[model samples]
Target chain A: MIEVFFQYDFLRYSLFTGVLIGILAPLTGVFIVVRRLSLLADALSHITLTGIAFSLLLGRYINFFAVLNPVYMGMIFAATGSLLIERLRHTYRFYRELAIPIILSSGIGIGVVFISLADGFTTDLFSYLFGSIAAISSTDFTVVLVLTTVVVAIFGLFYKELFFLSFDEEQAVISGIPRRSLHFLFILITAVVIGISMQIVGILLVSALMTLPVAAAMRLAASFKQMFFYSVVIGEVSVLAGIFAAFHLDVAPGGMIVVVNVLILLIVLAATSEKILNRKGG
Target chain B: MKNSAAPYVLEVKNVSFSYGKQMVLEDINMQVREGSFLGLVGPNGSGKSTFMKLLLGLLKADKGNIELFGSPVQSFRDWSRIGFVSQKANSFNSGFPATVFEVVAMGLYGKIGLFRFLKKEHKKKIKEAIAQVGMEQYMHKNIGRLSGGQQQRVFIARALVSEPELLILDEPTVGVDADSVRNFYDMLKELNDKKNITLILVTHDIGAMSEYVTDVACLNKCLHFHGDKNDFEVNREEMMTAMYGHKVNVIEHNHSHDHHDHSHDHDDLDGVRS
Candidate 1:
């Protein structure tokens, strides 16, 4: 397996990209889960799919777009969709969660229109939807690396502020944590993470990578810091194992990674339940 | 020990606020002096929350001027100087994955500013704040595992961690048990008397409020009364009846009285009917 990775540039690129996504996804996902915005990741990923479909459609007609990477287009749409969701949330302050479904539906609606306009699904579209080891180009690896660096740096700088904000937003605002700008930056980062993660985990399963490990970690970890650390560890293990299994079994790395995440979650739940039962018995 | 430059920790002059077509607070002029504990009492929808929001700059006053530490509320950038513990603090999500130390450490985030990490001194301050609230035993404990009263104490510790000159608490004792409520007020009184930290507490517990607070203010969409605790006590029944828009009973209890007997009475203003 080690020699196989060394021999094939494509496999090495997928491995590198997978490792970066593994770290970035769950790192952002911890905040998302705590804030009760797990579904927001799903909404943003669907919007990214719209961007990918639009780019693919444009590529069919325009020579310039033919060589353009769809990930950039996807990022732009996801970021815009995030801002739109924020705007809608403010517009309907009482029913803030409604913004997710509205944006999510619009994303899928527009995405389908673009997909149909591009003359149905192709092998390229399938890879983008479900992710493929062969689909991760050298350029894709470089983009993921840069995104991972930026996301990690942002988290490092604003870790405390973000934690306070996530724990109790009203208090964070009173303490003058620049609530508006910080929240805007947070949602924008979430959108971008979802946008980039699609290349490794695919659009449908992108949110799984972001949320599943965090869910599992939440059960086992006592503190937010512990939850954060555990989430990243679980994410890395799942991604690395998924990539290796995908190489041997010839399946979508996204499916394998998500399955591993679910498996871990089930194991944690079973172990914690037994502990609860033992405590009750005692 | 008072800062002569800013004698008043908080000043609200003719501050009026309203939502769409409905007034929440009107012409509310109040001043909180340095080292004084002021209890703000009002009914459920009497604009206590709105007034706190205005003071904290969460909501802009529709009509008047508000100041914090002698600076205009709008332009006030030194937020760490004023600590706030909201009503929502008592009702936080129990599933939130943070230890008491981590939650209290958040108080220093604003003071420490961006792109910086918590140092040894900050950690020392966090532990001291936790100790101040007598939550030292639960420093590493998950906050959700604690009882309601314990959680409330941890929140106070979170607010105190910044060592603010003025601490504002909005209904900090809600959901706290009767005995713990008394102890909670004692801790707050200690913070005010020992540390000389100016305090503003919003509560329905008029009985407890009168016992601990140096000053009192009554509000019901308007500033009904703001004076010394003695004056509030003298006019307690009349003022509360007028403010609540119904007959209100004032069952005064001494500091050494058994709290369990009258705990339900002091929990809510409406609980003591007739």
Candidate 2:
């Protein structure tokens, strides 16, 4: 792997982006899982797909868009989708989850229209849908790196506030944690995470990379910090293993990564099943 | 109520709030003095929790003004001076993966502000808050692993960690056992008496409210009665009548009547009230 990275810049970019996405995805996923907003990630991922599809369509005709990175457009759409989700959730307060499906459907609707208008399927669209090792560029690596840094920095700044909000939103509000702004920031960050991660993990499987490790971690972790650490570790391992497997097995890295995460989840469930069952029985 | 040179910790003047077309709170007037334990009692859907939310600025009042520590609620940025334990604190996210200490430390987050970190003094305050709630033994314990009452205490500790001058709790002991409920009130009393912390407790347990609180406020979408506990006792029937919008028998139960097998006692109380 070291020799391959040294020999091929594409491999280096691919692996680098993979590892960072691994860390950032599950770190934010801890909050998503805890908040029961895992569906929001799925919605945001679909929105990113729509953005990619639209950018692709524009690139086919427009000189400026042809040179621009599609990920930037993906991020803008994802962020807009996040704000819309927040708005819809607030508007339909009782049916908060309603935002997810509405956004997801709209994303697919727009994406399908854009793909059709662009005169059909392309290799780039396929890579964005399922992620390809050969598709990652140095620019994609930089974007992922910057996004990961932002996520880490946000957490560092608002760790306690986020924890309180996630743990007990009522208390967080009463404690005056600026619930509205903080929550908005959180969803925006979630959008950005999905946008950056979709290059390696792909739009369809990106939510899995965000959620699966945290889901596995939640079963055994004793505290919030422990859950976060375990999720990051699990994510890192899954990403590395998936990348290696994809290299050897000649498969899409996104699908391979998600498969690795599912395997890890199953193993964790198997190992902790007895204790969980006993707990329930007792 | 102990005068104790205590100023008004909270003041609500003609406050009214509504959700959509439904009037949740109507023309409410209340003032909580410093070093006072006030029990706010009402039936389900009586807006007890909504009233707390208004005071805590969680819900904006449709009309009227609220002041915390002499500052208008809209301008009251010093949240550390006011602690709130919401009604759903017990039932919210029971499986939340946080330790007792971590949960308590969250109380200081607003005061600690953004971009800064918890200091040594903040850690000490967190520990002290946990110890105050008698949850020191479970400082490192996962909040989800604790019993309902234990989790409630952790929430109280979280509120206390901020060292607020006034603490507001909305139904803090909903599912707690008799013993734990008793202990919970005793802890609140201790905080009020020893620390001069003004307390506004919203509870359905009128019996506990009458016993532990220095003052009583009867509410039902409106302020029916607000006075000392003795005065509330003197006008008990009238207060209950105003609260239920019908005549109700006031049961004469002893202070120590709360027990684990409270079903029978509750039946009798219900029989009298109904």
Candidate 3:
């Protein structure tokens, strides 16, 4: 099993891609969960699916589309969807969460239409939806690598500002934090993360990979920094274990990774609950 | 450029604000002198929050000029010099996974500027601010697990971390208990007196605040009364009746005799209907 990784380029590519996504997803996930925008990740992932499906559909007729990676289209569609969500949130104002459902439904609706136009779900679509170990190519690895570098750099530069904005938006705005541009950049980055992560985790389960580790970490960690640290640790563990198990079991890595995350969350919840009960008893 | 020698820290001249056709504040003129603790008291929907927003540059005044530190608010960029703790500070999501230390550290983000990490001096400042708020023991505790009063104190610590020249608090004692409210006010008074940080506290509890505030400004779509606390105390009944459009009772708690016992003066003006 260990020799298989060195022998097979696909296995090595998928493993490296998983490692990068594991770091990026949870890093951004901390902010998303804290801001109570967990559902926004799910909506954006669905929107990325629209891009993926559109690319697949276009490949049938357009020679250029056949060579182009669907993940790029997914990223483009996801970015557009994120901007629309921001615009709609302002439009509704009072019903801000309305933006999530509207975008979510439109994404899935448009995605289904595109999938149908592409003559229904093929094996390639299946791999993209559930994630396959063999499907990750060198090109996919390069995309993830570049995106990881850009996202990490942005997070590093604006870490404090982002933390302040997430905690209290009104106060951040009052303190001259450029709330509009920061928020715009935040959601745009979130969209790109969701789009790129779909290669290993699939669009359906991408949000889970982003959110579950944060949820589990929040239960155990005392501070935002601790939660961030713990979330990345949990994300890395789940992705590595899930990928390894998937290769051995010949199953979808996305499902295995989400299951591992769920297991970790349950364990953390149980442990924390017992601690709380003991504190009350003593 | 900060006019450190300027007599007034804030000046609002003929400021009028409206939301669409409805007027919230009308031609409000007020000045907060340097080193004075001004308590802005008003009934609900009396535009106290809106006034604070205008001062913080969150909202633009429709009809007048507002200045902070001798500079027009439109061009005044020294935000770190003015710290603000909003009314919603206590009402924040308790489930947020940040410690008291992490929460207080965020107050320096603006001052620290972009792309900069917290240095040793910044960390020392954060700890000192937490100590100043008397939250050192709970420095590592999750902010959500703390009591409303403790959380409010942490927010005040956050505001103080930047060492601002002016600190503005809006209804900071809304959900705080009677005892904690007294301590909160005492802390604000200490900040004003000892640190000489000019304070602007917007609250409904003008009765409790009268002990600490150097000046009082009663508002009801307009500045009904703005004067020294002594004048406010002398004409408390008449001024409150005129501002609230009804008879009101002003309970002045004597701090010298029973500083600890605040059960009688627990509620704000709304609680004291008579």
Candidate 4:
């Protein structure tokens, strides 16, 4: 197993993918939390899963777009999913949250139908579902690398505008911040992050990677910058540990990674609640 | 509806706006000069905010041309000369991760413009604006940690950060305690009187606005009555009747946090748009 880790180029790709996702997830997560759209991430992620299943079925059954990559198809589908959800919410003139359940059910229903029709999957399905440390291509590595770089750069450059829009959108619009353009940009960025996340975390649990560390970070940090800092620090730690454990245990890296993140969240909540109670008691 | 001859900083001449078929504002003609404080006063849903929106280009007037500075979109593309604070000032994601410095820095985003970031001079302006609002001590503090009045100062600093000639505030004092509201008005008056920065504060707090404003404009579906606050001292009944559409007994709620929840005309901004 150790030899496999060192010997395979795929293993190297997997390691790089893990590290990239580790940092990127929580960076975007802070924005989601700040904007109060944490659950929206979960809904979009499930939409990605449905897209992947649909693409795989199309490639296998219909033989249409036979040469196209299923992962790429999934990315496009998920982005469209996010966009459609946004559009429907606007058209309905109600809370955007109303679209969440409808989209979520559609994703799950389509995923179930595809899973049943595909004659079931094996460890290869595990590769797509829970992630594989042994199935990455150089191409996949490059994709993940580009995604990480672009996400980081976009967030850094637009930090002020996004902050302004998130905190006081009316103020941003009133001060002539080109808020409608920024609003579209923000949703597009979220779709991009979710699109890229499907490569490693997969649709099954991408939002966990995106949301868990931020939830933990929110425990102690009062300010947005501090919350972002703590979320990234915690995310990096979880990914490193998840990768290490996956390396030793011979289990699926994706499930292990999310489980590790959940454990960290629980621990953070426990620790925070105690401190809050103590502060009150004192 | 465009009053081209009037050399006012803002003009909404005979304008009207509506959502679907329901008219929100009707035949609203108003103007403000560059260096004068303009108080926007009305009951809730009386089209005060809608009028502000027409001027800010947030919502377009259905029937008239709204002008700002020289033109609407022209100055909209360049709003460094204007500052604004909405009623829901700091009620955003309270658990957000930014400090006070970052929040104030966003005021200069228009000055910074698209495809660029804040420069050294921008940072200096942010610091100076914070100090001017007496929030220099809280510059490094998280925006959520401050009290309501302090948060308001940060917002005002954000407005002042860009050194705008015109500053417009919408219902900035509701949901706040008495002393904080007083402090907010004091700061606003000081800005107008001392710095010569023009202000347009929209609120139901009539007495405070009447005391501080150089000019007053009451909005219902139309421009009711506008002149100096002394117009209120002389013609209060007429203005109130025009605003309410009937004779309203001007009693205890005259100078208080009168939350007019039954108002159906204006849109609610309680939720953060994300």
Query: Which candidate's DockQ is highest?
Result: 4
- Which ten-residue region of model 2 chain B has the weakest summed lDDT? B265-274
Cα lDDT for residue A9, model 2?
89
TM-score, B chain alone, candidates in order: 0.89, 0.88, 0.89, 0.87
Q: Which pairs clash in the backbone of model 1? A: none
- Interface RMSD for candidate 3 relative to the native interface: 8.4
Per-residue CA lDDT of candidate 2, range A1-282, in tens? 547765788988888888888889999999999988999999999999899889989998998999887878998999999999988887877667888999999999999999999988888888899987776778767767777887899988888888877887766766667777888899889988888788887899999998999989988788899999999999999999998888878898898898989999999999999978887886
Native contacts recovered, in order, as a fraction for each? 0.71, 0.69, 0.74, 0.55
DockQ for candidate 3: 0.43
lDDT of 1 by residue, A1-282 (tens): 757976889888988888898899999999999989999999999999999999999999998888988878998999999999988987877688899999999999999999999999898888788877776779878878888899999999999999988898777767767767887899999988987778878999999998999988988888999998999999999988888887789898888988888999899889899756864575
- lDDT, candidate 2, B116-189, per-residue tens: 89999989999988888888999998887889899999889988888889888877877778788778889888
Candidate 3 lDDT score at position A237: 95
DockQ of each: 0.43, 0.41, 0.43, 0.44
Better of 2 and 3 by TM-score: 3
Which residue runs of candidate 2 sit more than 4 Å off their true CA positions?
A: B245-274
lDDT of 3 by residue, A1-282 (tens): 767876889889988888898999999999999888999999999999899999989999999999888888999999999999988987877688999999999999999999999999888888788887776789878878998999999998998899988888777777777777888899999998987788888888999998999999988888888888999999999999999998898889999999999999999998899867865675
lDDT of 3 by residue, B154-220 (tens): 9999999999999999888877778998998999989988898999998777778888898899988
- The regions of model 4 sitting more than 4 angstroms off are A1-4, A58-69, A274-282, B1-7, B73-75, B245-256, B260-274
- Candidate 1 per-residue lDDT, tens place, B1-274, comes to 2234538888899988877788878898988899988888876677777777778776678898998888998898898888889777866788788999999999999899988999999999999999999999999998988898999989888888998999999888777778998898898999998999999998766887677888889988899999788887788788888887778654553333322222112111111010
Q: How far does residue B66 in candidate 4 sit from its true spot (Å)?
A: 2.0
- Answer with 1 or 4, whichever has the higher TM-score: 1
Taking all chains together, the TM-score of candidate 2 against the true structure is 0.92
